[model samples]
Target: MTAPSQVDYHDVLQVWREADTIPEIEHAWLFDHLMPIFGDPSGPAYEGWTLLSALAAQTRRLRLGLLVTSNRFRPPAMLAKIAATVDIVSGGRLDFGIGVGSRPSHPLARHEYEAHGLPFHDTAHAVGSLAEACTVIRRLWTEAEPFDFHGTYVQLTGAFGNPKPVQGPHPPILIGGRSAATLRVAAEHADLWNIPGGDIDDVVRRSALLDRYCTEIGRDPASITRSIHLQVSYDQPSITRDAIGEAIDAGFRHIVLGLPAPYPADVTRWVTDELIITSAYYDSPI
Candidate 1:
């Protein structure tokens, strides 16, 4: 098994940045996963794009990105522009996670259409849209001049994205979802696949399936990174250390932890302590 390589923490804005001095923290910053069904509705409506810029400014030496951003929230062209801007702000520290949009009824079974607007929305339609969106994002990033694209869902004539992302070929694209359609899309387009928390058996199974999908699609399975998001509550003093180690042992290249909102001093304390110690531990490798 390939040894896993990283551990990431999510939703770190708990307590709203109150603590003593910010300690040196290492590891990827998994930004907001949701895109505000009610307009950035997570404690005071911090726009995801703005928050990412702030986080990048606040932290140094840590990679930053959204764990996953849904497709429905914005257009691909706009997303590409926003991501490029963030990448520039961070000096190229951004990684992006894209997914088929998720809304209230949670996949919106046809029966739940009434609850949500727009006929419960269709998963296949969303998936197809997301795939096309991915194509658009990449094309816009690489195209030297403003270009034209015509798609079933998106139509752009002479769209020029300026100040392209600092990262060559664009920041890494981490696609999220466990469905076959999602997997297929990732295989064709994504640089990484974000898997949510599950048991070891589940991880192994999903990993294998993803590998197979990549093979079927003529993609090099090794080229794609595997990132998992976990809702972790730690009892141990060195929780982050333990968590990162565990994830690495399980063959994940990247790991994301979902922390509560409101930014607690204790949360910062633990993260700082754990990150400093973990960096030391990994520096020399046991």
Candidate 2:
């Protein structure tokens, strides 16, 4: 995963293009943020979905997507259309990741909403809207006929999606968040659940809570794949390797290594060699 902030487009393209050729790196990702969340507050931060579409058009054989899109940024129906377009562009390699925007606790994240003239709702509103967004997006992808939707957070009239995503049914929905409310939404809508890697015990507890939510909803908990995003430490590959091992042991089969910028020369190769291949759990079936 590469945060598209504080980096050039060519640099991002270079890393992704390299990763595409490496079979070990199955997927690549970009984060959704209108402004720089780290480094210079005024630094350039490319729009994620736009850049994702560009990357999708350039790469083949590697599944790709925004690490998770912010549901608050765009209307659900419009986002469904955008995602479908990207799926078509990528020949169906898009993994649709989304979340309930940023948390209010993070000052950097909170500022973007106001910066872009987007409302910053309370946590309850954000979570509820996310649930509605998922429902509306799925219907837009799968429903053949135009439909009307009325929900607390979403209202649509004659909403329909044409040129359905190339993927049958729809692209895999990957929801990223650690909140219990978000987990409940994931229990119902996500094909995969992702949380930032740290505090392995807490992650395990969250995973258990998701399982309980799924059980309560009569959905198989195992149906949702567990995913984790572990930040790559350029200076110490061993640290990342240990984290990967722990995440895998914790039942996270999908591991997304977050690459920090400025990306080194042959960074993807370095990732495959030093981080992935040398991981203690590298020999274990993933």
| lDDT for each candidate structure | 0.65, 0.94
Give the range where candidate 1 is weakest over 10 consecutive residues by summed lDDT: 1-10
Instruction: Rate residue 172 of model 1 by lDDT.
Output: 88
Give the poorly placed runs of model 1, Cα more than 4 Å off. 1-25, 28-45, 103-120, 236-246, 262-266, 272-286
lDDT comparing candidate 1 with the true structure: 0.65
Per-residue lDDT tens digits for candidate 1, residues 1-286, read 0001121124443322422144343344443332223222332323456677776766555566765666766779999998888888888878887888564455322222343343334777788889999999988877898788898878999988888899998888989888878888998998889877767567767777889999998888989888877654545546555655666676775666555443344865565455434543454211
1-286 in candidate 2: lDDT tens per residue? Answer: 9999999999999899998888888999999999998999989999999999999999998999888999999999999999999999999999999999998999999999998899999999999999999999999999999999999999999999998999998999999999999999999999999999999999999999999999999999999999999999999888998999899989999999999999999999999999878776786322
Candidate 1 Cα deviation (angstroms), residue 130: 0.9
- The lDDT of model 2 is 0.94
Top-scoring candidate (TM-score): 2
Q: Estimate each model's TM-score.
A: 0.76, 0.98
Q: Which stretches of candidate 2 lie over 4 Å from their true place?
A: 283-286
Which one is best on lDDT? 2
* Cα deviation of 250, candidate 2, in Å: 0.4
